[model samples]
Target: MTQQEKNFEGSLKIRLYNTKSREVELFQPYFAPRVGIYSCGMTVYGYAHVGHIRTYTNSDVLRRLLEYAGYQVTQVMNVTDVGHMTSDEDAGEDKLELGARREGKTPWEIAEFYEDHFFSTIAECNITRPEVISRATEHIGEQIGLVKRLEDNGYTYKTDVGVIFDTSKFGRYAEFARLDLEGQEAGARVAVDDQRRNPQDFALWITNQPNHIMQWNSPWGRGFPGWHIECSAMAMRYLGDQVDIHTGGIDHIPVHHTNEIAQSECATGRQYVKYWFHSAFLNVDGRKMSKSLNNLYTLDDVRARGYSPLALRYLFLNGFYRRDMNFTWEALESAQRGLARLWGACAELPAPTGVVIPGFIEKFESAISNDLNTMNALAVVSGVLETKGPPESKASTIYKMDEVFGLDLANSRTRLSDFWRLRGLRPEHKMQAESMADKREKARKNKNFSEADRLRDRINNMGFQVEDTPQGPKIVPMFDFDFAAMRKPVCGHCGVDEKTGC
Candidate 1:
């Protein structure tokens, strides 16, 4: 075996910060050489913003590192097409219904449309798709089965609204999140639901809400599964009764994940997850991203503002996943420049000779093993670029590092051209125009100006003008557009105009 292969063999212990334990713990799968991971996925109510991208990116790195460490990993992620409500608690409108109303479409249509956007956005960021993608709507039977188990175990109570998981029956319900049960208020964040015996009790099956757009016939009634129940049900369905790692946003700690633990463990009579992995929130301009502030930037927003989605991924890696990271246009610009240079350096390297610098590989592995310390891992990548070595060795080492980084460094040649063209250009429009331009280029090659003109006209209709340059078609937006300002919706939470910064 090559020396680099030897380096990755054994003695590579991974440590992850378990939100349940409140400390970094050594990661040992319950079953050797096999790891089960379940990451919380998009709700598919709207466009996946940059905040969602950061959490999924962190999850991707975790999965990639496990694979790199030679573990047979089964990663399951859920698409929350239904059940997720506006409030984490059962006190608000169904988010799918809300989105459907806004778009003048059915709940299912809204789900499919936004789900596609989520997948495409993550792809642009180079996040590896989970091996199993479970949708809440598709898994309704499983969700109902889980609720039945909870009911049979006497951990559930029937209410006018539906079947509610009785938090009082679970002794360790608050241990995962360390809740001050006595001090907690019932209606602090969401409206008080008197039907619940305890404020902490969450719904397992929601019923009696005739207005809910997405409904299913369940044992409880003709209703739907609750938001928290879907995750627990879906996670157990694919990854077995217990998962090695269950990842989500830190905001889920107090409510969403805490309820998941309560219901799942109570029903199964065993621990549901060994480790709880949570990523901190991504703030915009040092403030919480708010619709009122007009800062909930989506992947398309990032691209529309002349930045590579991969560059946004790079910015995310520079910060610790457990700590809140602030986002700004300035920071994104810096990330784009740094990524461009790295891609450029890779492009200039000599061809790989199937030799990886062992030292560099070891350091990169060490950083990722320590709670996915991507910021330090990125620093090690910088070190590899500067270290004196045979060019082939350096090239091979960087390529190996890309296994964990997922920067697409192996295709830096294409990225260099793509990245350069993307700068100072609205990437979303440019991307759309470029697709048409490519067809137009093909048509022109075939001496078909009429078809080329048709394609050009389509591009123009989409508010983009294509310039046939020596390099290729240069796509420029016909008008300078402040896409961000166009997204300035009234603050859904604060009930104020965004211009006033409520």
Candidate 2:
């Protein structure tokens, strides 16, 4: 291995809380230099809410950190275009079909519209796209093959409604969730699917009713794959029978992820995934976000409220991924001001022309290494700003740190410049803004409070806000800029700038 690889393997120990193990452990890739990751992606039945965004953002940070640690990482995310039911027990209507009926559109149209919206929303948060995005509708053959493997292995049984996985056959069925099988069997919460052999058994394929819109040919007759099977099939097809990591929301643990472990392990006759990572849910105003409560905030909703999407991203980083984050408008507004302050500080620093300060990068790496503790990593950023150091070294170190934070810190000046140009300001306006900002900093250092306040007010009246940071005083836009309007839509699948639409 090269020196860089040795450094990564030796020093970059990332400890993560594995849901399956129910404890934090050192992350060891199944393979040496290459790592395979599979994250459960959007169902595309509706616009992605803030809860979904939080999950994806956490996954994105994990991927970014791994790549930064000198690993060749391949990430595959599955888009559930079909076969996801409203109820996790597999009794409710298909989510896509339900969305189609609610929106007065075809199922395919509903999937396409929301899929586009999903990509657009994540892009606003600067999320890195996955290397391979697998769609369930496009991988029907693979899903069928997986069901056949399970049946041949005697892990499935025929049911009147569809083929179902025999959870009892898998001895370690509830090991991950530690479920109370007896309680579940005795409770009324279990869906009454008479076809199932046991209360905990879940569907592998669902025989479509005559009115169903999305159906495919299968040995079990015309039907669709189960929600859990789609993820297993697509994940194995792209990554392998076994992967380094699998990630999803905490809601997936008891049913979806447990079922995936049972069926995938039985079919492959090997360990399915080495690490299972789950992110906590986002609550709104100390209550769960529900459509009936009208508190399901989307990226568009944040934009409508004049808060940048990155503000929400920053808010997520403030809390640990495994800890529940409560979202209030008040919290979001505080995060917006926090992000503006960061941008303002970054704007004041000159372009990085010095080498990275020794010990600074190591401090950051250590913080994230400890169970992806982004909250501590953010605190390290604050420490960097407060430390007595050359501006060049601090700027360079922060630019490197943005690889994991994804805050676009290095381009703060460019973003501000673009905003000014879009507002019809000339180049001289930027020069004038910088000059006045310098004068304000000098006055503050000279203890001229009145002069400093006057200069600050002058900058604010010109549509710019001056923020004082540990490093120095900096300037930013008076209000949040519409980052989505700054660029045209780019196709997530095809790397083309789609002027009309993706």
Candidate 3:
């Protein structure tokens, strides 16, 4: 290993929320020198809601920070296109079917459309993509393979409704649910499903009817894989029988992920997951933003209401991931104004005097190392902003902290209105991006368009794309960037040149 990789993991502590512990514990991967992660991705029959963003971006940031901290991470995300039903019980219509009816398209079409949108939103939020993109439909064979393993192990039983997993066989099935044993036996909590053998048993596979538009033949007959089964099968197929981490929303704790554990552990006879990370809900005006409540917000909803996608991400980071965050347009506007200053802070980066603020940096690292205490870590970033130091050190600290905040702070001159105000540029990020355009005027005037285009390529690599139109080359940000620190070269098309004329 090179110095970058080697020096990265010298007993450095990271705390993660373990569902098993139900509290933050020091994060220790099952294997040293390698890490495996599995995140429950969206059920792609519809556009992702704020609820979706909560978990997806939370896990996304975690994975990125993990990599930034020097651990090699293999992350897998399941694209849940099949097997999810309207009811957690084995009886309702498939979620895909419901989505198709609502949208007047085939389930496959709905999946494709919404899946694309999901990816776009996540990427816009600056979440990194996983290494292995596993689709539940693509892993039918693997699901069947796992189901067979459970069947052979005597943990599965066929019934009139479907191939149900016998939770009685596992006996320890409800442990992950964190329910009191007495309350579970009395059915005192939660929506009840009497059909589920022991109030905890769940389906491994659901037999499909001939009229169903999305059914496939399986070892158990024509059926769809169970919702929980798909995640388990896809996760194990990619990460192995045991995984370092499994992440999803807090909503999944009661049924989806808990059942996943019962079935996965029943099949493999081993610990299913070491760490379970879940993000709390993002409330709108002190009320939970939920589909049933008709309070969900779409990306367009947020934009029309006049907030960037990132302000919402910032709002989330203010409160810890394990705690609920309330959203008000006023709050988001404040975040926007605050982040605008963040860009100016980056633009103002000065040289490091090599005077280490050990006291402050230690507190910051301590926050993150403690179960990714992002709220506190954010406090550290704020403190860094307040420190009287060389711009280089302050800027360097902000960049290191972005590894956890995922705020793109180092490159968000575009996101900050103050940045625009300070630079005397237009409010729109694209306008600021033009100021960061690369200079190729010398090469272009020399008619070495090749060199000029190469310069354009370099600018694009820095996340600005230029279009040569009759009006001249218009530069736009492919996304946000730290414009002040950007090496804005002279515009070739605009005839701006360094040391020579276009």
Question: Which candidate tops lDDT?
Answer: 1
How far is 99's C-alpha from truth in model 2 (Å)? 1.2
1-502 in candidate 3: lDDT tens per residue? 4454445567557878788778878676776556899988989987787767777778877886677666789999989998777765566788888999998999999888988999888877777888998888889999999989999989887776678888778777667886665565445543666556666667788885555688778777887887788899988988899999998888898888878888889888899999998888788889988778787877767665555677777777776788888777788778766665566576556544445466677887788778777788888887888878776777766777787778887666555643243333333344434543435655676888888877676566545678877666777544344444444454334323333434
Tens-digit per-residue lDDT, 30-108, candidate 2: 7656889999999999889999999999999999999887678999988899988776556578899999999999999
- Cα displacement (Å) at residue 23, model 2: 1.3
Give the least accurate 10-residue stretch of model 3, judged by summed lDDT: 418-427
The TM-score between candidate 3 and the true structure equals 0.78
User: In model 1, where is the ten-residue run with the lowest total lDDT?
Assistant: 487-496
Higher-ranked by lDDT: 2 or 3: 2
Query: Candidate 1: misplaced stretches above 4 Å?
Result: 1-11, 88-91, 424-502
Q: State every prediction's TM-score relative to the real structure.
A: 0.82, 0.85, 0.78
Distance from true location, Cα of 262 in model 3, Å: 1.1
Give each model's whole-structure lDDT: 0.84, 0.83, 0.74
